[model samples]
Target: MLRDFSAQALFMGLLTAFVGFASSFAVVLHGLTGVGASEAQAASGVMALSISMGLCAIVLSAWTRLPVSIAWSTPGAALLASSGAVEGGFAAAVGGFLICAALIVVAGLWKPLGRMVAAIPATLANAMLAGVLIGLCFAPVKAVAFNPAFGLAILGAWAVVGAFNRLLAVPAALVAFALVLTFGIDIPDGAFSAIARDLLPRPEIVAPVFNLPGLVSIALPLFVVTMASQNIPGIAVLKVNQYEPNPGPLFAATGIFSFLSAPFGGHAVNLAAITAAMCAGEDAHADPRRRYWAAINAGVFYVVFGLLAGAVTAIVNLAPPILIQAVAGLALISAFAGSAMNAFKEAETREAAALTFLTTASGVSFGGISGAFWGLLAGGLVMGVGRFVAARKAKKV
Candidate 1:
């Protein structure tokens, strides 16, 4: 392992962690707050998720000898942001999070259940994800309308960097955002003082309420989105990179960590898709076997970043809301494009996929369930009917 260590690998690992965290940390914060968490609680959630995913990445990579990078559930965060609030407030949301984590653990331990999750149609899943992302993707353009100077600077930086290296684009945009925050706008009074006071993140134990409505709405949708959007794509990334570790144990590890972190504000942790590709690919190390060290290095950095969550939250709070959303939207543009492509890639699945995308994007909610869940159900129904009709026509022929 020591022989495999190189400056290039180290830099790649650090860059992966930076890009992953900087790109989506705001989404996590927004999700937590949207679920009714206080500022401190949201900060705690960020710290917990960062630390949990980091430790999981480190342990899994060292043990499996694969670049098994872990990440906080970004789509799950998007689900939370779109779902609004539950009946019992943050405590209920916390309970739902616990349920979601437990379900993941179950999916890991039970092969049949895992297969069922795996059997979810990729088109429908991707369509649902596209729906979730479509709203946020427009934020950059909206921000340009709201505050041209701040928004355009970030967008321009992303566009320029993306032209050279797509992986670095979001992080570059984040840097531009920070520069604009520093020089373009006046710092909010007492923001620095708040940062000093909350320099260390403190875990706030939210007692779980277990409301039925919250469980059905938040817990179920969170589990489905996490598995479909994050884990499945993550495993595919590993396979494409010529690494196939036992996903069962990996799922269990992430689920266990997520379960442990739930009471302290973390939502969910799972196998990473985007950042995992960074660590597992040739960019991290020439030798695939040596790439595990890059993941280990990234894990170390994630923990360090988590420890500074309080300071990070303080700085984020000082930024304009539109600018934050705009940066986040820019970060997700690649993902949105990928998902949209996958959703409509097949001729047979096009109509179903379109329905899923439209329903999910419509933000329709019923019986306390989220639009994502409803959209998937609607799309799946259409797909099933289409298949049935095709089979009947074939029999007649």
Candidate 2:
């Protein structure tokens, strides 16, 4: 079963695996900044999530002979940076992690909640995903305005790779990344000395505190956003890749990871769809049995990356901000388009789906949870009622 392991496959897999870790570091750090975390705390949390995901991915993938890669939850990080930045600060952000972990643990333990989540319709889920990611997509366009040259370079690279995908195959993102780096396009600029000085080999943990304001206003909303925005799409990615594992165990693992790391500022952990797709593809390993090694390879890199957290931070800082924004936006384009298309595909329920999309895009917040979750819920309820009414009328006839 472990017969075929080409060097090329290993290289592609490893490259793809490093993507989210490297790409999202800036955003994570920015989020930390928003929450008033010192640069050191922000970097440490990033290191923790990277190392934890790497370890978990290695064990799970090798044990199951499946290509299971994990990354810091992008949506979770986004929510933390935005809302968790307000009111309660970093400690409040920790509260968010604790709340999300507890809820996930309960869901993992009780099958009913999982089932209810599963019962949500596919189109609606896609719509929710689109809404959740709309901000991410438009972010790059805005970045171009900030730094036209760098943003355009990244976009141009994407266009070149996409046009040649048939010939270039899986190396497109890698090539694009290389070209941007080589072209003297600066995305961010953190000096090597500054990064080395800021490195934290040991992390300081902040114990969970229960403030009604923190939990209800901050933590609860963050939890809702993580579950609704991050977890759902993560699971969908798994299903899309035909590696749909037991949801209970998966959620359990995430909860356990989150619970353990919350005090140290670890925000959220979940199965990664974009990065995971790299491992699931035929290119990662022709023989499915050995594909797990690709994830193991990624995990190994993650551990190594964790040890060099300071250097990694420095490197991210050197890259231009526009590059980060453009790449992130470009990477997520397919996901956004897919979600939007599904959101409005049906005639009868299209209006409800539109409501969800618009509300989510508006970025409104009642408490801590982003509008994406509430938007989907409200739209889904309306659609469900419409279906129920139509079915009842048909039965009477």
Candidate 3:
């Protein structure tokens, strides 16, 4: 294994960790804040997720000798962002995280449970995700509306750098945001001192408070999105790169880590879809057998980053919320586009998909349930009725 460690693998691994963390971490922070987490709680969540995923990536890569990357559930975070504040605050959200993690574990250990999740129609699944993301996708514009100077700076950085390399766009936007924080926003004289003091890493264990509304709204939606959008696609990415490992064990491993981290306010962690390519692909190494080193390398950096999560969260909190939100919105644009495309791709299911998208985007809530759950329900009902009507027509003929 030591002989297989090439400079190329090391570089790719470092790059993978940077891109993965830099791109979507804002989304994680935003989502955590959205669900009524205090600054300390949100910081703890980010810290927990980063450390757990980093360790998971290392263990999985070393165990399988495959570039099996792990990540916090980005889509699940987006779902939380869309779900609005839970009825019982961050504690309730943590409770949901526990439930979601348990579901993931079950899905991995029990074939029937995994199969049931897989049975969800792809179009409806995509539609529901699209609906959840549409609002955040517009945050760039909203940020601009909130403050044209800061917003445009971030967008401009993304646009210019994105033209050169799409993968770096979000990270570039993140750079612009740092500039905005440094030179643009006027900080209170002592804010920096306070942030510095808060930088010390400490895990805040939030006690869980389970509620029925939280289960249906947070746990259910989070589980579905994480599995469908992150875990399943992550496996496919690895397969595309020709590194096939048994996915069930991988899923179970991530679930176990997620469960362990939930008490510290982490939402969820799972197989990484986008960054998995970076670790598993030829870019990681010339020799396919050695690509696992890249993931392990990335894992090391993730742990390092996790240790600094408190600092990062504190720095981010200094800025106006919209600026961070804009960056997060930039990060999620690709996810939203892909989901929208998949949702409406088939003509037969387009109506149902559209309906789902519209409803989810509307951000409706009734009886303590979120729009995402309702949208999925509505789409499934429409699809079921359509299928029934078609069957009846064939019988009449």
Instruction: Summarize candidate 1's per-residue lDDT along 183-256 as a digit string, tens digits.
Output: 88789778788689878878788998898867877898788889988887788999999987788888888899
Per residue, candidate 2 scores C-alpha lDDT tens digits across 60-127 of 77666777777777766654444435455677667767887787777777888766655767666666
Error of 2 at 144 (Å): 2.3
The better candidate by TM-score, 1 or 3, is 3
Which candidate do you rate higher for TM-score, 2 or 3?
3
Which tens-of-lDDT digit does each residue in 145-264 have in candidate 3?
999999999999999999999989999999999999999988889988887787779899999999988899899999999999999999999989887789899999999999999999
Local accuracy by lDDT, each model: 0.88, 0.66, 0.93
Cα RMSD (angstroms) for every candidate in the order listed: 1.6, 4.3, 0.9
The parts of candidate 1 lying over 4 Å away from their true place are 1-4
Residue 34, candidate 3: how far off, in angstroms? 0.7
Error of 2 at 349 (Å): 2.3
The collision pairs in model 3 are none
Task: Give the lowest summed-lDDT range of ten residues in model 3.
Answer: 191-200
Best by TM-score: 3
- Which stretch of 10 consecutive residues in model 1 shows the poorest summed lDDT? 363-372
